[model samples]
Target: MNAKPTEATLADRHVLYQESVQDVEAEIDFVQETFQALRGRDAELLREDFCGTANTACEWIRRGRAHRAIGVDLDADVLQWGIDNNLARLSAEQRGRIELLQQDVLTVKTDAPDMILAMNFSYYLFLGRDELRSYFRNARLSLKDDGILFLDAFGGYEAPMELEEPRECEGFDYIWDQASFNPINNQMTCHIHFEFEDGSRMDKAFSYHWRLWSLPEIREVLYEAGFRQVDIYWEGTDEETEEGNGIYEPSEVGDADPGWICYIVAEK
Candidate 1:
């Protein structure tokens, strides 16, 4: 009899990423509730920029029958993987409500959406201020008059440190490696690795060379991009555990945690 393959060899990185890195349900909940609170109305159309597997777009479609989403990314292979895996899981009607475009996020144009999402710190890939601002301007211009753009950012004292942090997942351990950092330019190289219980490892499953952008720089860029209002939604702390409570609200002040993630909301 033939020997079985190791778990790492048999596993799909995209599936692992979705299970460990993404919480589409919570993401959609935050977006839907926040948009309603800010705009005082339900948002029908959403566009996800740098949408890797379109997992979040699929979630948006499942949220409501009238909801529609457009996912934009430059990676055709990833988009195809999404169509084959994520989109396939959706119902026929839900599948019809979403579209995946293999194009650059900076220039891709679609129907004016009520909101756009640039989550997962994907915008950090733009190293220069001008390039980042240009992309933000395009995103703002692509939105409807009353549209809002939502982005997630991460930072703190540990953000620039070179280290590897691992968390136990269901069948594997997810590892985040900060491989290298340049303090002068705030550029960093990071990688995601997976370790299976069967003594198998998948190294550098996903890698990124990104600028470690600060909240102040990001907010200023949004203003320069012509967004009328830009707000940072800081995560609240749980009184019991003193950890993030999953409740984010607009705030002018935030605690200096060792590591932190917050949302940036820009209104056009």
Candidate 2:
């Protein structure tokens, strides 16, 4: 008889990644509430750039009957996986309200949306200032006249360090490896790996070669891209535990922790 498969061997990287790296529920909550608070109206259409697996887009569709989402990505396989797994779980009406476009974000054209999301630090892939700015400009053009762009960024003293951090997950261990970094260019190579108790490992399940952009730099580029305003939403600290309290508010200052993640909101 054939031996049983280890969890790592049987696991799907996309599924594991969704479980470990993404919280679409919280993300959508922030996006929706922030947009309504900033714009004084509910946002109807949302565009998700570099939307792997279209998880967030699906979540947006499920939020309301009028809510619609467009997910754009260059990876066809991942898009298909999202259709098969994530989208498949949605009701037919929900699926109809969302679209997954296998197209490049910089050039893809679609109906103007009320907001555009470039989350998961995916835009970090643009290594050059000009390239990154160009992408931002393109994103701006794809939005409504009063549209807003939402992006998540991460950094701190430890961002450029070469290190590996392991965290316990449901049935396996997730490891984030900062495999390499170059301070002079602010470029880095990072990867995610999964390990199972059965002594099996899924190495390099996801890898990224990205620039470590600073908040000032990102704000400058957004302004250069013609955004009327930009704000950094810093996470609040839990008074009791002194950890992030899961509430992010617009702030001009943030703690210089070893590592941290924050959101950038740019209004057109």
Candidate 3:
């Protein structure tokens, strides 16, 4: 006889997403190290655009008393969840240094931050060239004169394929479904699904309708938005393991792998 199916909860989805996708500590470390290398000083203020649960912002504040973070998103419910969960785990002083705003990233105004991050490819939600350029312009304006914008992007031959890939985690199977792709416009629809051990599954727990932007397109927009310089950080492959070593260095060329992710640093 088969075991009974257990329905997963929203909390389960969040936990799985974080465990499977985010490395907040590593991300902050990269931001700090990269900024120091470029500017000869540490970055103090950070703005995480499309912050979702604000995990990155929470980690940013935990770095030091001098560090302050701002998380901007349009989803009030998700922002509240971050406050209740991630923020609640921080010390009062650390929590005091972070702010969450339920506002559009393009229109929200704040003090110029030393670094602005758009990780997880959230900026892909802007499907039009005009909208994306507008966003880059707004982001540039929100930064200090020496500030840098950090954005992550993924692409390769496999990205446009309509297929689902599953990886087994500790308690569940994480599924990345590429539901549909339109080659004409580069519009792609993707979803995140989870299957539990008890045969229960959550389909489309998170869905994204994005226009896959190429690296050249993104770089041109950033330049048009008034960024003084744009640099690409390519991940290094480990010789022993034949996998990404989590070490990224500035590069002008990247390998033609089946799939890859890299960071674009735009200086204002």
Candidate 4:
């Protein structure tokens, strides 16, 4: 067996997070609900795009007994990490049922599933209309006859700008920093940094260079890609705190906000 790599110190955090199945269930529930809402049926097969560590794939398996999942990513290191971390949490049957592959999601050849989920803004890695459209088309092709595609998107009035904020987690702090945003074309750059006890700090652990695509624009692309329908699941703020309370409800009143996050579900 290969030795485990040392946990990166605060100064070096390319591995910004070590997620497991539970961490991804929250997102999977939203994806599944959105798919059912549109198709009027439950999804059975799920394909996870850019499935780093395959956390969501493992979680999908647990959502129901009939559920199956395929996790596709280009990084073999994280594939192995998933086997080491997330896959262990699965039952023997679930472990054998789910499949994890290391390949470019854009070119991967496999059977279509009921739904494809692109979570954590992973699609943001692609920075062009043509490239993104190609990916969306590929996703459509990779879906089962009645499958849908689900993606989580975030942006608002002031998306392309440098900003930093911290959140409290169970034991550590989670920080999402908007390192740069360009108003000219909605090109944006962001980073995830972590601060630990003992006054240790890690900066620029993981960076993303993404085109800040709008809801209408993405929906248009989904329609162009042949999806029969597209729906937006807007985020709801906590009544008392006026902060995003982590619960998302289906709605079309997706308006501008200082910062907002929501899901876009497309049906085929």
Q: Would you list the C-alpha lDDT of every candidate in the order shown?
A: 0.96, 0.95, 0.93, 0.79
Task: Please provide, for model 1 over 1-268, each residue's C-alpha lDDT reduced to its tens digit, 9 standing for 90 to 100.
Answer: 9889999999999999999999999999999999999989999999999999999999999989999999999999999999999999999999999999999988998999999999999999999999999999999999999999999999999999999999999999999999999999999999999999999999999999999999999999999999999999999999999999999999999999889999999999
Task: Give candidate 4's whole-model lDDT.
Answer: 0.79
Report the lDDT of model 1 for residue 220.
98
Q: Model 2: what TM-score?
A: 0.99
Between candidates 1 and 3, the one scoring higher on TM-score is 1
* Candidate 1: segments with Cα more than 4 A from true spot: 1-3
* Model 3 C-alpha lDDT per residue in residues 1-268, reported as the tens digit of each score: 9764465643367778888889999999999999999999999999999999999999999888899999999999899989988999999889889999999998989999999999999999999999999999999999999999999999989999999999998888899999999999999999999987767789888999999999999999999999999999999999999999999998998989888999999999
Candidates 2 and 3 compared by lDDT, better number:
2
**lDDT-best of 1 and 3:** 1
Give me the candidate number with maximum lDDT: 1
| lDDT (10s digit) by residue, model 4, range 37-84 | 767989888899899888888888988999888999998987888887
Better of 3 and 4 by lDDT: 3
Q: Could you give the C-alpha RMSD of every candidate to the true structure, in order shown? A: 0.9, 0.8, 2.0, 4.0
- Report the C-alpha displacement of residue 246, candidate 3, in angstroms: 1.1
Residue 42, model 2: lDDT of 99
Task: Candidate 4: give the clashing pairs.
Answer: 160-181
Q: How well does model 2 score by local distance difference test?
A: 0.95
